[model samples]
Target: MRGRDEDVISGRIVEVEAYRGLEDGASHARFGRTQRNAVMFGPPGIAYVYLVYGMHHCLNVVTEVEGHPAALLVRAIEPIAGAEWMRAARIAWLASHAGNRSAVAIARGRDRLIAAPVTQLASGPGLICAAFGIDARDNGTDLCDPNSMLRLEPAPSEEPPPEIACGPRVSIGYAAEPWLSMPWRCWMKGSPALSRPGPKAAGTGGTDSARIEGTEPQ
Candidate 1:
């Protein structure tokens, strides 16, 4: 991710969930295409961002072929570079919730961000958006393009990939039967940055039932 000043921030992906059109009951395209979910039925390697609970935005990577509404929800990331930028972005975002932030409030937010563990920096989809300054304007961004401000890059070849584990997707109680239990959520095994623990611990219920244009998690 890049700030307005072009200061770049990086994070290592740690968790994700998959959604597909029509067949996937939990997906927004489960019905058909619309202006809101057009990005999901993509040429691939682009973004599919949406809001949840009238607030928090979640990011996804468009997948499959053009006309195929499939995408991967990026649930968590491990902050790797530009920690200060990410922290400041997150603080500024949080401060905006109540209106313009005072000098004292900004200072207190900085203290909180500093006190927080690095592992918690981008440990959830919403947090990742807050830290990276992403919103609906970035919904169709070409994440694979090097020129894109919010680009995604593969880990260095010398670095081994983390062990991955799959389980039921989170906060989709709206889905029915088999889809409800389908283990599609994948995450780096044993990563402390995961948005949630194992399936046995996650369950099917979600805190918020509100959805955004039928694309949100819950």
Candidate 2:
């Protein structure tokens, strides 16, 4: 989970797409260093966030050596903790900025017996951020430090993480050809939390699910 006292929100990362600057046409670094993509060129274990369509804030995790500008775009997640807080955060954001009543109603599905599953709370990049109170303010957020409000932590389990899967990233059709066909996306295979459909990955389904693992924040 990522949060502070009284407001903890967590999710099972299900989908992600990789971006490589310079060599890759879809990367923000295709044009070289600038104000917006500077963070991606920095050290690893930090968030490289960007605003898309003037509203959505997409989150990426900086990885590889510094200056290489490689990141994994977090595409989707299944909410697992503090789900109510996630809904409230999203609802509040819409109420103040969009006044999207219906969206808020769907978010605030308080009908218990008919209440929405927490898994649906964060199914997409924008929705995931909103559900977790993550924004541009967290663009340079550290994912390596446990103390940071936004941090990557180990899965609360002793067993090994589920198998990883790869597929072509969503959107960026403009990249064309090789870039388009490159299966750089990663995820916990067969997760319903996936943002969209893709080729079936190996060793998915059953009781297996996504859990924080490897090098956790801090």
TM-score for all models, in order of appearance? 0.83, 0.81
Runs of candidate 1 with Cα error greater than 4 angstroms are: 1-6, 99-111, 198-218
Tens digits of per-residue lDDT for model 2 on 100-161?
45764744543431355666677788878877878889999889998998888777798578
TM-score of 2: 0.81
Q: Compared with the true structure, what per-residue lDDT tens digits does model 1 show for residues 1-218?
A: 55434467888999988887668889888888988898888799999999998879999999889988899999998887887777777878877774567878877877888788887888899999998888999999999888888888888899887766777788999999677867678887678788876444435544212222334342
TM-score of decoy 1 = 0.83
Predicted model with the maximum TM-score: 1
lDDT against true structure, model 2? 0.76
Report the Cα RMSD per candidate. Answer: 7.0, 5.9
Q: Please list all clashing residue pairs in model 1, or write none if there are none.
A: none
Please report how far candidate 2 places residue 200 from its true position, in Å: 7.9
